[model samples]
Target: METNTEPQLPYMPGLAGVPAAESKVCDIDGQKGILFYRGYPIEELAEKSTFEETSYMLLYGQLPTKEQLDGFTHELVHHRRLKYKLIDLMKTLPETGHPMDALAAAVGALGMFYPHINVMDAAQRHGACVRLIAKLPTIVAAFHRMRRGDRDVLPNDKLNHAANFLYMLNEQEPDPFHAKILDTCLVLHAEHSMNASTFSARVTGSSLADSYAVVASAVGTLSGPLHGGANEDVLDMLQEIGTVENVIPWLDKAQAAKRKIPGFGHREYKVKDPRAKILQRLAEQLFARYGSTPLYDIAVKLESVMEERVGSKGIYPNVDFYSGLVYQKLGIPMDLFTPVFAIARVSGWLAHWMEQLENNRIFRPSQVYVGAPPRSYTSIDRR
Candidate 1:
């Protein structure tokens, strides 16, 4: 079939080979190597706003006043407890199930329990957002405890989001320094215009499904190594390399064999990912406050080598590089790294769902189908 050669839409700047996700909000100036969230620079928000505050700002277009933030915090803490039905469902999962898999299943089950979650109603949507933000820690902690045959740790309402999550996970209230690190890490991971997971959410919501349904699908996407689990893999990569001395040969050999670094090369920002810088600072703080760990040394050495090796090719760390170190240092098992990402990202995922519903258009992008010409079916006996 002959087809018109002229492009229907304006030629898009990036192709599928690149790592760009097309969400209306955030943009990265790869040439200048700058990153912005809802048009606000990451550094500005990182400096001025708390994780909770930034999350609220991203969800609502405007930043919340003090009283509104207080109310949101109160609401989040008040609902931190799991619903009885949800707890019962969690009890049924095999203890061997991966925490990420378990959380995805539990969150999806929540949608069935409250199937009427209105994708359009701001209040109802915020209710879902609050539930996800509050309860993810509880679910994650419970899964961890269950796997290890330990008792569940309940949430403490008096603490902040970062402290409360750490408290629940560790069964002890974390000190200010540790909580602060977690707060910054969560803020860094909060939103990106639309990644594979966020786009998965939007695409699912385009079908007009409830927010939970879309988020559940997105969680599955985030569970993948290429998307969110790269943090865990980076830790694994470092562990396998074992020392600063090993960094060079491992990287050179991987490069020689044509392997892309797990934590390098973003599709949107050709220069570097802004979130990587934020996480790198947190990792540095953790390393500086506490005496050195071999993993930290390995990462630093790898960074220097990789920068010299791949700087011209635009291969650099994304959000995953240092996140594993934080979790590992926090005494969190390596298995739960991506689940932590999901916990923080639930806020952004719901924010996008709300955005999608506001002037609702189904997310149906046309495919450029390239295929064989129409032909008749062959006869059954034609050998």
Candidate 2:
């Protein structure tokens, strides 16, 4: 036999373009800049559906009827209150910790309060899903308050999901306009097919971990700058630019140094991200109500400059670009941005978790060996 040597296939860094699993939960058409959940267009969902309705659709795979939505809304509202022990746990967390860090820790601790259930039981999984969704906003709001030496505000069941979160965080009821804006933001952020955090969620859930642990893993993933933290960076960039005149100089320096302009590009979007478009409209509407700030003008000019320079390369403003401005106008603290992302994304995370459990498999991908050939071990004292 003749020994033949041939080059092996190149490894895809970061598993780019790899299809790890099948999902009916979300569909993304990157070329068209379209996103859907269970065959419903995201634009339609964001415009017509409330976050509660969207969450139910993502979780149960269809738009709920009036009766079903009523029950689902009731369950979500009823479970919004955190256990007293959980609040005490939040109190003990260092006030200096980032909200994302505090959120992941709090969610992980939820596994302790609500013990693991039968992974295969549909009802038990649904219950866990509801608890995680309901309690996440409370956890986020409590951490926000606790970090600032403010008293924790309890959840008000009378308010809708988005309104209740704002109430808890601000310790006062939000105006209806502000509440609707937050609700739309939540719907926009609810799901994206196989993003970094969602992948972390499904991978963790594949090991038969409880839903809390799975979501905790995702929260950790989203805490990274490359993901959920991008919104904060976008805001920081706009603040640094300060004025419309500074936008051109900043872009020139950034381009010369090859530094990324945060919020200008996304891997999955060739056109402007649909979510970004919606957020842009929301930001404008917010500016109309609250009056456009200097930073919003800077953002608009920066977006125009980026579009002129890089739009042909499939680079455009993403969901992060305008979302931070909207949140800032809504009076959300800068640090809590990612925590709010987690609050919205938990629905998608739970959906992926349940789907992973439905078709169980351990996620153990093989890596190409790129090390020394097999050799005998040497003694510790020997070289």
Question: Per-residue lDDT of 1-383 in model 1, one digit per residue for the tens?
Answer: 56667577534433354443345456668766787778788888876777788778778877899999999889888988887778778888998888889988988887877778766677788888888778888888887887777777889988998898888877899988888888887887888776788888877887889877887899999987678788888888889899888888888888789976777778777666777887878777887888658998898889888888778887787778888888787777888888989888887887787777767677655556568776768988984
The sequence of per-residue lDDT tens digits that candidate 2 reaches over residues 213-246 is: 9999999999998888889999899888888999
| Residue pair clashes in candidate 1 | 19-267
Per-model TM against the reference: 0.91, 0.97
Model 2 residue 19 CA deviation in Å: 0.3
The lowest-lDDT stretch of 10 consecutive residues in candidate 2 is: 1-10
Candidates in order have lDDT scores of 0.80, 0.92
lDDT of 2: 0.92
- Report model 2's TM-score to 2 decimal places: 0.97
Model 1: how far residue 292 lies from native, Å: 1.4
State, as a TM-score between 0 and 1, how close model 1 is to the true structure.
0.91
Q: What number of backbone clashes does candidate 2 have, counting pairs of residues 3 or more apart or in separate chains?
A: 0
